[model samples]
Target: MAKILVLYYSSYGHVEQLANAVAEGARAGGASVVDIKRVPETVPEQVAKNAHFKLEQSAPVATVADLEQYHAIVVGTPTRYGRMSSQMAAFLDQTGGLWARGAFNGKVGAAFTSTATQHGGQEQTLFSVIANLLHFGMIIVGLPYSHAGQMSVTEIVGGSPYGASTIAAGDGSRQPTEIDLAGARHQGELVAKTAVRLFG
Candidate 1:
């Protein structure tokens, strides 16, 4: 049974929604186990803002050991000033030990993100995530244009040829559109399937 890790940091729940969709897709693609973990909030107010989900208590803080058990990893984060959030950046930075040991060598990695606007650097965020994976010697995967929904522009609401993403409205009231969810799921499935092919 292959395991895939869905790790993310969400300040407003938008990225959490994307992470759930990605996990659903990965499970559908036959990953026997899916580990969903969230980065811990360093500030009390930030934790309070996310009280609805109790993310502070329920979202496990991922460690380098947690990363090693998975055959594939899908990282998610909210777009922060055209990049991944500082929380995620800090988490990735701690992977220096893993990088030194080539702990992620040949493993499959994918990225997902949510932004407050349509052009809020979702692609850039995904790229930044992929860049770290590259440093760790991981194989990065992205959504392919051949997926059924990919051919339909209506299904292209979020995510891209590079990775998954969501256009989270500024107010954070608008949920991800069906297309956005579908694209995210598809990206997860792609990553899972690729991991199986490469590592199984």
Candidate 2:
């Protein structure tokens, strides 16, 4: 019974939708406990409201200590200039204590993200998240080629061997397509399966 946490920070609900899909796949992959949580928003309340940020998210705010309880942590965030959003980075930065004690040394870690365009640095954002997981001594799980959907050239899709991703469009109108959500699910399931085999 592996415990998996789908941790994410979504500014426009794009990544949130993918987070939920990831949780669903984790459950299907035999993880008994799958929790979806979001990091705290660092932007000022007024600024967030003015920017029309999605403030009505339902996931509870995750604390640094929460990372200790999961066998695997699947992270999601929106891309900001070829990297992860500052909100997600700030939250992960607080995990220095966990790194010092190797609290996550044997855990499985995976990443997912959303971008504003096809070439909006989705892979770079995933690498940024994976880099943090590596520093924590956690094993990295990417959206592997086994997903198959990542190779599709039929439609405008968001996925890669690095991780699952979605194009949110410049105006924040385009939502994640079905293929994007499927890739996220595949990555989450793989992460959970790896954790179960390694930790259980």
Candidate 3:
């Protein structure tokens, strides 16, 4: 059995939905333990509320030390200017000690993200998060072509060979679609399965 952690930073709740789907998939993929947690919010509560951010997230905030306890870690974030949000970046930046210790070495790592538009650099954001995981000496896993839903032409969905994603509208009115959530689940399942094979 693999222990998996779904860690994410969601400003408008879209990534949070994907995080939950990822956890669900990990459970279905034979993981004995799956925990979903969110990174700390960098913005002040008043600012977040003024900006209409989803402030009442249910997942407990995770600390840098938490990364050491998981066999696999799946990260999710929203794209900010074709990169990861500062909140997520700030949280990951604190992992330098873990990097030096190789605490996550040889573990499974995967990334997922959301963008405000179809051309909003979803893949770039995924890479940004994956790059941090690489620095932690993790084995990278990506959303593969086997999840054929990414090829759908019927809808404006988000999923790439880099990772699963969803296109949240610019006004933050759009939520993840079924296809987007499925892609997140597929990536999570793959991550968990890979961890089981590597660690078990």
Each model's TM-score, in the order given? 0.90, 0.98, 0.98
Candidate 2 weakest lDDT stretch, 10 residues:
147-156
lDDT of 1 by residue, 108-167 (tens): 999999898878899899999999888888889898775455456643367778887777
lDDT tens per residue, model 3, 64-128: 99989999999999999999999999999999888888899999999999998999999899999
Candidate 1 root-mean-square deviation in Å = 2.5
lDDT of 2 by residue, 137-175 (tens): 889999889888778888888998988999999999999
- lDDT, candidate 1, residue 160? 77
Error of 2 at 179 (Å): 0.7
Stretches of candidate 3 off by over 4 Å are none
On a 0 to 1 TM-score scale, where does candidate 1 land against the true structure?
Answer: 0.90
Better of 1 and 2 by TM-score: 2
**What is the alpha-carbon lDDT of model 2 when measured against the actual structure?**
0.92
Which runs of model 1 end up more than 4 angstroms from their true locations? 46-58, 148-156
lDDT of 2 at 61: 93
What lDDT score belongs to each candidate, Candidate 1 first?
A: 0.82, 0.92, 0.93
